[model samples]
Target: MVIYGVALLAFCMLVGIILGELLGRLIGIEANIGGIGIAMLLLIFLSNYLKKSFNLGEITERGIHFWSAIYIPIVVAMAAKQNVMGALDGGFIALLAGGIAVFLSFLLIPLLSKLGNK
Candidate 1:
């Protein structure tokens, strides 16, 4: 069952990559990887539903490990690029935005959880 689930996950990702490439070329939206993002979001919801409805085992931790492994090379390549130094010019802005996002999420999650419980 784990093997089957793994295969299915790989297939979904492959399809997402192919579709993303095709759509990016067609629309001239330079290098958009939105399909993979959409695929991941769908997978998250599907896995949650399956786990709650059918008692499938939680595989989120394993999935996170797998994705981290997959993204490491891409991250390394990006960091190696010539413009990497220039990219850090906006580091402070990026940090601020990220901090705000984290703050909002931290504030909202507990409130939302409490509201849901009520």
Candidate 2:
């Protein structure tokens, strides 16, 4: 069932958040770092595992794909929220860092595109 796939994603998200929090604490921070990324990776691995080990129906696969499709936008929204909040508190250093990151990312586009062409 599609619901089953959603349940699996939810389970992975819960586990990922817990692990991320634990990792943050281990590093002496107080946030769920990389939780979304972890959840996405876990979803990928688990879905592949299930596909190989069990006969997941079309509906379930659809459900997983649905969430996967929206995952990026969700991550972007969350990150944007964090960045806005952080930038306000972080001031000049944060703005400078963001600008550098954007510049570097833009600079890498051509190189990355060339690599992809090969």
Candidate 3:
């Protein structure tokens, strides 16, 4: 059962990667990151359906933890790079952009949710 879940996850990721690459290439965008984003979105939807259909409570939580554990070190290593500090020299702009993004999401999510309900 666990192996089946793993296999299904891998298959979904591969499909998402392929689809993202095709779409990105057609649009002249970078495929690797786009592929990952598409893969993640597809994985989320598929996981929800699989959990409901299979009664696999907390499967998503497990997957989240697993991925986080796998990626945390990679992220930390990237952040540790000397160039990362230099990149953050535009700290004020970064903060402003971050704040704007947060503010927009705060306003947008509720409005979007309401619209979705309609």
lDDT of 3 by residue, 17-76 (tens): 898888878888875546777777887887778777876545545655565577878888
- Residue 58: error of model 3 in Å? 13
Choose 2 or 3, whichever is better by lDDT: 2
True lDDT of residue 49, candidate 2 = 86
- Name the regions of candidate 3 deviating beyond 4 angstroms: 32-88
Please list the Cα RMSD from the true structure of every candidate, rounded to 1 decimal place.
7.0, 4.5, 5.0
Candidate 2 residue-wise lDDT, 2-99, digit = tens: 99878887899999999999989999998989987898899889878887998889888777789879989999998877756756788888889989
Off by over 4 Å in 2: 69-100, 109-118
Write down the lDDT that model 1 would get. 0.72
Local accuracy of candidate 1 as per-residue lDDT tens digits, 1-118: 4555676577667777777787898988777567887668666787778777886555644654576577878888877876756756768997799789999999998788889595
TM-score of each: 0.43, 0.65, 0.53
Q: Each model's C-alpha lDDT?
A: 0.72, 0.86, 0.73
lDDT order, best first, reads 2, 3, 1
Q: Candidate 3: deviation at residue 26, Å?
A: 1.4
**Candidate topping TM-score:** 2
